[model samples]
Target chain A: MIRLERRKEPSTFWRVANPFLAVILTMLAGGMMFVALGKDPVTAIRLIFFDPIFSAQFGSYSRPQLLIKSAPLILIAVGLAIGFKANIWNIGAEGQYIMGALFGAGVALAFFPLQGWYIFPLMILAGAFGGFLWAMIPAILKTRFNTNEILVSLLLVYVAERILAAMALGLMRNPDQPGFPGSRDLRRYESAHNAELIAGTGLHWGVVAALVAVIFAYVMMTRHMLGFHVRLAGQAPRAARFAGVAPARLVVICLGIAGALAGLAGMFEVSGPGGQVRIEFAVGYGFTAIIVAFLGRLHPIGIVLAGLLLGLTYIGGELAQMMLGLPSASIQVFQGMLLFFLLALDFQTNYRIRLREEVRR
Target chain B: MILGSINPAVLLAALMVAATPILLAAIGELVVEKSGVLNLGVEGMMIIGAVTGFVIAVNTSSALVGFIGAALGGMVLSLLFALLTQVLMTNHVASGLALTLFGLGLSALIGQGYVGVTPPRTPKLDLGWLSEIPFLGRALFSHDIMVYLTIALVAGVWLFLSHTRAGMILRAVGENHDAAHALGYHVKRVRTLAIMFGGACAGLGGAYLSLIRVPQWTEGMTVGAGWIALALVVFASWRPWRAMAGAYLFGGVVVLQLNLQAAGVRIPVEYLSMSPYLITIMVLAIISSGKARGSLNAPGSLNRPFHASN
Candidate 1:
């Protein structure tokens, strides 16, 4: 009987091809899910994967929307990918994102009615600082106390969400609107608003920043010493230690960067499409970014492309929800399936599929 | 309202009831993690358990059957997790996260029909005369059978970890899978079993929420309860007994918050609502200080993937 054996080094061919193979499998499976839901499977599949960027009827508007929607996902995922590469799991980017919005909105709300562009920049900085501060909690705890960062960071998400609710209903409630559980509209604030520079297109500074993040991330992973350390630590922790990569420092750096990026994404969202702070401002983008990071193979360019592809799904998923009566949660399941299949197919990298010999009884 | 002195005793009872779900789930998770599997899908499993238990109980009118259904539902989900992370050697972290996501979606789908449907009440186990004693009876003896079962589970798990041969083997596997594998201990089987056990406990916890606590089905009823259980595990320092204490502490915080709200305390409802989560962070920070010190029982291979080559 043929038996499977692992290679000393992984196959480069399968390393790249697996993701593509997984995507095709996911599409076919996801199409089946749509069909099972009673919609025309082909049209539904095209809507989810193709229509957003290709169909002449929707491509123009959807193309720009793709960039707009992907901004937060790419920025946050790029930061997270570094940590994932280092085997540091920070599952509370959603919390960091909320804290960033809270802090940035606090700044913008403080400077309301002032028509200075500096105010907007200041708010952005504050947002980033807020997320950084929140993230540092887990980082410091993990390094200093040997506490599990996974638990620490993730639990903080609930706290952040509750704080957001408090701010919306109590601290940040609009003075003009009575009994409404939301904050002042940031977009309505002349100086601090993050509106589009071009008409009809949703392109904003946030999208530009995401593109910049992609470039920086690409460089950092390929050329920076820290990136190598991250990869080293994840692949072989003992070997990483031999190379003088400090685990504590790596944890702090990865967490700090991730928190800051998530924070900036929050700030941009609060200023841009999200428009204002509300109890429901968080739409699960932080969690969704994890999928983006993995789907992109944790490669910066791949993350950028993956973020856009995911963005397309978000838009198209909504379209199908309205037009075809498809449940929106299917989109979440579909995203989850992609990760699951991507992981299951990873066996190909190390071991070949072969018929197994019977074990000695 | 009964004109009586402030029922600190009754208040404590509420705390115990509130903490049961977290305690049960965390204690179960503690055992699983001891065997070296980090199953973050507890939240997903719990929610499915919640809905499944609610649906079954509503239809059949039996809390006991509902608990069984919840456990089975959770086990079914765990099977998927086992297939991917154990059999396929996928990254445990990603797979667990995916399991959680799938659980969330599947629960939402399963809960569609059950939303707003009322579940039959979980009958409290009246411990006869012991339950009638002024403070002790009300606070400790009087509760649903599941609550007592949870406390028993904690003690049972604690005993197993400290006293049993199998426990030692399970611990050995978590500490060093390669060595355990060489010793002919079925590492994958142990981890998979632990994961299933954890899933069942999480399902029971979810059932408590639907069948007793809220007594109704909901879309996202378990909300961050699974995450809270995860935090409880760390707070317990991965010890079965300490998990009980942490869950109770968290439960006390929750009960007190609701009490304050009922009393119309001046604090914003949001801050009051956030008290449990905020306290969790504070406690985590305090415990996590000094060194990355985990419990002695914490599995050595907690997040590592095991592979054998001859």
Candidate 2:
């Protein structure tokens, strides 16, 4: 019989190795799923995992799309990881993101037909502010009224979506295109446009912001006192309180930072790839970022890598849908499997498995 | 005149149908919480159930069999959660979140084939002469079997948690797992069973949505109903009867808002659509702000993974 024995301290080797192991396991599971769908598992896996990066046919187009897809995910995940580190769940980043897009779009629309050098920077600020303001609803409620942030944040997502739909259909609707439910395409607008920074590389201001956020998070997590407090709070609340770490303050700060980052991502998306404040403006990026945060082991650098990996899956999954006749939902299931295996195999980091016969009577 | 157009009996009947899915899911979560496990994957499980029930009912043409399929699908999905948190000792919150992601994806994938397909009609209960009786009969007895089943489950859960010896043991296990373990109670087993029951109920709730509520298969038919159910459990303070009441109240709000919208009320459609979520958050805040801690009655061991050995 096999038995698991608890370890005094978590295994450092397993801590690092488990994520890689989980990826391999997910690939295998995904292969089986493909086979079940009456496709050749090997070709499907190869197309999804390898072809996007290496193949001459799809790689050029997909490689650029990878960065485009990952930028917002990385940016959002970086903020989420900060709050998650303090055990403050901010599941409503999606709402913050939508609000940010609206706020940024609202600014651009307010200055419609006006040419100004300051427009872009002002829109960015408004986007961040909008997200931060939306995030405060749950943060204040949680800190003051002791409400659960998870539920409050999540509920806000639905509210935000409704607001987004309203904006697309009513207030933000493009007057030029009567009867259509979408705003002016910001990409076509000069001052507010978040144009690609480099030719054909998918490198935009949002990508730069994501990179900066990653570096900023890395520095804060490893070299700052607040980071220490966040870690301490998550690990032990009582001990943190004794150490003079204020829980409410931490909650607010974490939520604020996360909201701002998510909002910035949304603003960038709406002005660049998304093009307008449409009905489906808020996709599952906010929710997917949660998975990215955990998959990255809540580390800034790890999150950067996780974001790119997940981004690849998004591109590759689309490719599969188009090329292999695979269903779109398969990619979601594939991503879910990664988290499931990661969590399941995390057991190895904290415990040792042994044969039952090895135990002393 | 707007109020005059709305019949009280019809509104009440609509409210009960709207409430049944959430009521079923919340009561299941109530038992899970009472046994000291907080399974946040209700949304995921419910979605999975929704797809499974829809697919089976479409193929088999029996709503009863569809519900059973949904329950089993939910239970099977939740077994993964139980294995991860209960056996592997993973974090409940993270695992639960992952479960939701997985369930949503899985359901969407399975539902691809069933999209736009109308489900076999779930027959409403025939109370014979009782149906002729006025407002009470039409409002209470006219719902399909699942609606009545949901009400019965609430009573059953109340009795199981408050009066039965098994219920006492489940509560004891949740209150303090270590002490219960010392008393030779199987903590993991009890919690696992509770988790499975919660999953089944979530699935049944999902099935109801597909089979009777919406009565059609859509990619994401549940649309945060699971989250509402989760909020309802907290608002009810983990009591089965209160969960039912909270569900009904939410349902009433939903029905009222939709009716008002249809009647050309001045309120924006978006605002009306968002009222249920907004009100839920408001109620949660109010309850939590009270002198009593919102989660005071929460099982002491809730969210803490149990391990038999050090």
TM-score of each: 0.94, 0.98
In order, what lDDT does every prediction score? 0.85, 0.92
> What DockQ, on C-alphas, does every prediction get?
0.66, 0.84
Name the top lDDT candidate.
2
In terms of TM-score, which candidate is strongest? Answer: 2
- Runs in model 1 lying further than 4 Å from the true structure: A1-4, A35-38, A55-61, A356-361, B1-6, B291-296
Locate the minimum summed-lDDT window of 10 residues in model 1 chain B: B289-298
For candidate 1, lDDT tens digit of each residue in A27-59?
A: 998888877777798888888888888889878
lDDT of 1 by residue, B13-46 (tens): 9999999988878987898888888888898889
**Docking quality level of the chain pair in candidate 1:** medium
Q: List the residue pairs that clash in candidate 1.
A: A145-B291, A145-B292, A146-B291, A146-B292
CAPRI quality band, candidate 2: high
Worst 10 residues of 2 chain B by lDDT: B289-298
Question: Which residue window of length 10 is worst by lDDT in model 1 chain A?
Answer: A352-361
- Predicted candidate 2 versus true structure: per-residue lDDT over A239-311, tens digit per residue: 9999999999999999999999999999999999999999988778998999899889999988988999888
